[model samples]
Target chain A: MTSDITLILRFLSILGGGAMAGILGSLTGLGGATVLVPLLTLFYGIPIYFATGASLISTIATSAGSASGYTKHKIANIKIGVGLEIATTAGAIVGSLTIVAVHEAHASWIIYVLFGIVLLGSLIPTIQRSSSEEPLKRKPDWTTRIFQLAGEYYDTKLKKKISYEGVRWWLAEIIMFFAGVISGLLGIGSGALKVLGMDWAMNLPMKVTTTTSNFMIGITAATGSSIYWYEGYIQLFIAGATAIGVVIGAYIGSRLLLKITNKNIRWIFFSILSFLGVEMLLEGLDKAKVLVIATTIEEMISIAVAIIMISGLYLKTRRGERAVKAA
Target chain B: MNVPSKQRDIDSITSLILRVGVLSSLSLIIVGVILLFIRGSADGVSISQIASFHSTFNSSYLNPTHIVQGLIAVDPLYFITLGLWVLIFTPITVVFTSMVTFITAGNRLYIAMSLIVLFNLFFAMLAIPSLIHT
Candidate 1:
């Protein structure tokens, strides 16, 4: 338990995984903890309980690092974000309380199953809008005017200032509450759900959806993490390594984001989501004795499914492009 | 024009606070990790033991006073833990700053919303957690 060499190796390996998760998280607007949780649980053989704590702490790290840049650029709508935080922080309290019961009962399979479903479900919207960075234009509603949910940012990709207004503030708040609950229970930033709340329900631009979600995630994660801290879920060495590594990795990812096109990045993000979703589902099923297979075999099956899904996505996009040209 | 310019000032200040809070915490965490490895242990717990997921070191026992005491003793784990706390508190700090920002901007709606967020944060971070644990 006290070996020096083993300790160094563990630190390096966790750091590497956290870094990769950070890059994926920044590109996808899913916090690094989303990918990092699955990696620790499946690949590193860490307990899901401990992996969650590490993931939660690392999410704060990633969010804080990235939120600085997004807020500075004035893309993150502080007014809208704080308005929604009222709901999210309240939901986080409820989630943390619920998890204490779940943890006591040792019903972790439920978490894995839910995580799998959420990831798989989110992929649809990700794929549907992968080609278009512009959000669907919708007229501002009464909630929008009241909440002052409007902003303008210069899009480097479009090379012009784009002004957009968000509608359905109440809808965004409803979604944020659940997003916070998920963050508390799963120890993730739940940034994907936050993005969905704004991008889909509120009719915000993708750039704003992403940056604002990034800004909002820090508060939600913090609300959850304080509870995790009290519940004794955090391991100092593992969580610390993960947080530091993910921060460094997210920094690199934000730099790379300027050069890479969103479409290419979306593909990479979707593939990772598919692979992790299948892995979590199979693992949960196996744990529940619904089916049994060697862990290696499960990993292989997940890889195969990911490859097939990615290829199918590629073909569909290509066909769509062709149809658009042919028309 | 006046409102937009004032808003931008608040935004820039808020950004500076976030950058400092995050970067400093990261550095503290990194240093703490290095100390754990180089020292081969912290507070008599070996690095390998701490690195292991199953290590029985319960951070729940580390209250603010204990954390401060640990810091005095140069405990690597405490340093790392403090860093994590800093990371968590960063957003809460931002909420407070925003409250003040809204107050100065005379945005009554946002001030009320920010007050709710701040209340929730304090209740979660301090009041309820202590009540539950005790």
Candidate 2:
């Protein structure tokens, strides 16, 4: 009887946790895997491997749930997403294989540190572009014409048809390969990297980047999942419960997303990115035993850094808004 | 300018495929969880054991044959596993659909692109894994 009660509590908490991850994942197009993994490992004491398996499952759920909505609304550019998958899928293969070597060498901390730095570094471009609704127009180059890297979507918030052409397709592909590698190695969707590739390198609009990144994530996760399945990383009950919860959360998030502005979405993305970035860096350092800071101090420091960065961006955006008004 | 009708068709179909896949998988998972709650176990494995964080009951032990047998026996765990399998395959199905659509639209570039992507997926999901296992 005691065991039964414990089972019920555990099951319910996992379900609830999954729903929260789904909401944030769909809202920001980060696939929630990054958030879900940490939540499960830190709070529930689930093993990192099982947590990652559940994260991958929930990532697929979030992607499918939200991408369907985005596709119906024509916000996700399928053509561009499909074209880019070639690189990401190939990268996933390489990354998955490389993880075996890393695991053998006990060098997983390198990946953790690298991921942390990349997340923090990507924030610079995000903040720089936050003030603008769309990227500056660039002449369509040869790669764009060949890849058909152009699309138009009706922005619900702006209430206008936004047509954008992606440039530097080769650069985006290179970034996507790295994104896939990160996804495969970490077992997270790595949506931030995909968004960076498209938004920063390809010069696509934020909505298109988010939705298309969401669309692309499902395939990427699927690739990683097959390998995880073989490795026996997936705990079925946990994954199922989380996947169901994430779908519910994603549905709610998709509805909320359609009602919000691009700037609002970027703020949400940035806030999550900052927190996760600092946390990952601290985690890597702690694991490597390079930082002797107490866990509490680390947590406090992460919160402090996130607060400072978010407020800094907020103030910058406010000043930019004021300048635009003055002009 | 409006999106080309051909592109619009592809988008709608992709959305439909994803919607159907997710909803069906969700229903299966929900039913499986409900059944597990009522029964308090599956295939003689108690709920506590199966749901435990460190549970050894995972995808590695269950093959397709085992899943089929479990499904035939109406095991709730198998239902959940089946749902996950559906969820995993949904994106692959979408890719296949898009490839066919591209072929019909006579876009040579996209057909080749889609083919390469599809092949990569197969290589990762099937070819390389099976090779490693053997």
Candidate 3:
């Protein structure tokens, strides 16, 4: 029998993933996959393999479950999501091979580097309004549109009609290819980079780009994860616990989202991502014998403290901290 | 533009809400039935997700069957089992979506129907694909 504590912890991890997804999702205007994989693997002690598969399943669940919400709200741009998916899916296919190779090699150093890069991609550029995007190289040509791709979602927050022009289509495609390689290699969702590619290269609205990125993630992870599943890297027990947990958590998170302000979610999300980055660097240092302190005990205590504090704050928030978090 | 002066009788709306809620639950059951019929096991249906479903359901030691030989199915027992699941879960899905809809639409019937369609669509996407894959 699964211990009650383990089940609780498992539930907490899933909920935490959903909450963080909501938090970062609104912050970066992207889905939770980018933050989930590393967070699960590094902090929660879920293996990277299982983390990737579960994260992908959760992405499907999160997107599938929430697609109705976004659609009802009319914030998801089907055109943009579908259009960009061509590139993203292609990237995902490439990423599948890459992930298998790296995972098979079991190169710890490379994982550390990828983790740092993703962290850097996620953070380290707060000052820029909307984060400076790269210039679009060339627009997606006829081949892209032939698929009847391209869509638009309304940004209720901005209350402005936003349209997408896949600027620098070539550049974005290139990055997406690399992003796919990274996603495939690292078992990471690559949402952070995918968002950057869209926002910077395509010059799409941030919210639209982020939502579209969520739409794109399932297939990307699916590509890599199928290979991982085939290779027997994925642990079904861990994946199921994580997947079921994530779905419930994500469901709750969405409910809370409609009630809560986006700003509060963003701040909490940024704080968490920053901490994950620091913790990862520390872990790398410890692994390399550059750091003296072991994180096992500290990790447990930190997690416990975070749970206590967050839960306490959640209760307070429920008790009527309805003053909206600032935008 | 003035919002349309739409008023609904409370009783009528309440009945509509109840009806929609029941329909949504039934719709989910239909989906669950379809899914279970396709891929669910004769002995037991496991999640398309490989390991997690069996672990959670099996670990219970309370699974109706002692040993779920294969993936779970929509046999005669499926309804007895899933009906209980929907009995518990449908209300949650309906109520949650109803609450969300109420926040937006003042019309209760609208809220309830919206909830039904919204949730039905959501699960169908997951269930249909899952059923096929499993």
DockQ leader: 2
Indicate the residue-level lDDT of A21 in model 1: 94
Query: C-alpha displacement of B33 in model 3, angstroms?
Result: 18
Q: Write the per-residue lDDT of candidate 2 for residues A1-327, one digit (tens) a residue.
A: 787677777778898999988888888787877678767865687866687788888888889989999999999988889999999999888877776566658776665666578667757766766556677898999988888888899987888999999999999999999989988887778888898899889999988998999999999888888887877779988898799889888899899989977677778777777777787788778878898688788888888999999999899889999998999
**How would you encode candidate 3's per-residue C-alpha lDDT over B11-126 as one tens digit per residue?**
12322432343334334434433454345333354433222422333212223232133224334234323322332232234334434535555545435434443343333233
lDDT of 2 at A235: 94
- When candidate 2 is compared with the true two-chain complex, its DockQ is 0.80
Residues B1-134 of candidate 1 have per-residue lDDT tens digits of 12388778878877888888888888888888887877888887766677777877756756655778888888888888788888888878888888887898788999999988988888988887778867
Cα lDDT of model 3 by residue, A1-327, tens digit? 244344445545555664555445434534555577667767677655566655654454444444444434544444344334445545655565566566667645456546645664564322222322222334656534543224444445556454444555556667776766676666555667677776766666555555556545544554444445445544433443344444444556656655554446545755565556555655655555666576686466445544654465456554544444331
Clashes of each: 0, 0, 27
Docking quality category of candidate 3 according to DockQ thresholds:
incorrect
* Model 1 stretches astray by more than 4 angstroms: B1-3
C-alpha-based local distance difference test score of model 1 = 0.83
- Candidate 2 docks at the CAPRI level of high
Candidate 3: residue B93 Cα off by (Å): 24
Poorest 10 consecutive residues by lDDT, candidate 1 chain A: A127-136
Give the DockQ ranking, best first: 2, 1, 3
Per-model lDDT: 0.83, 0.84, 0.48
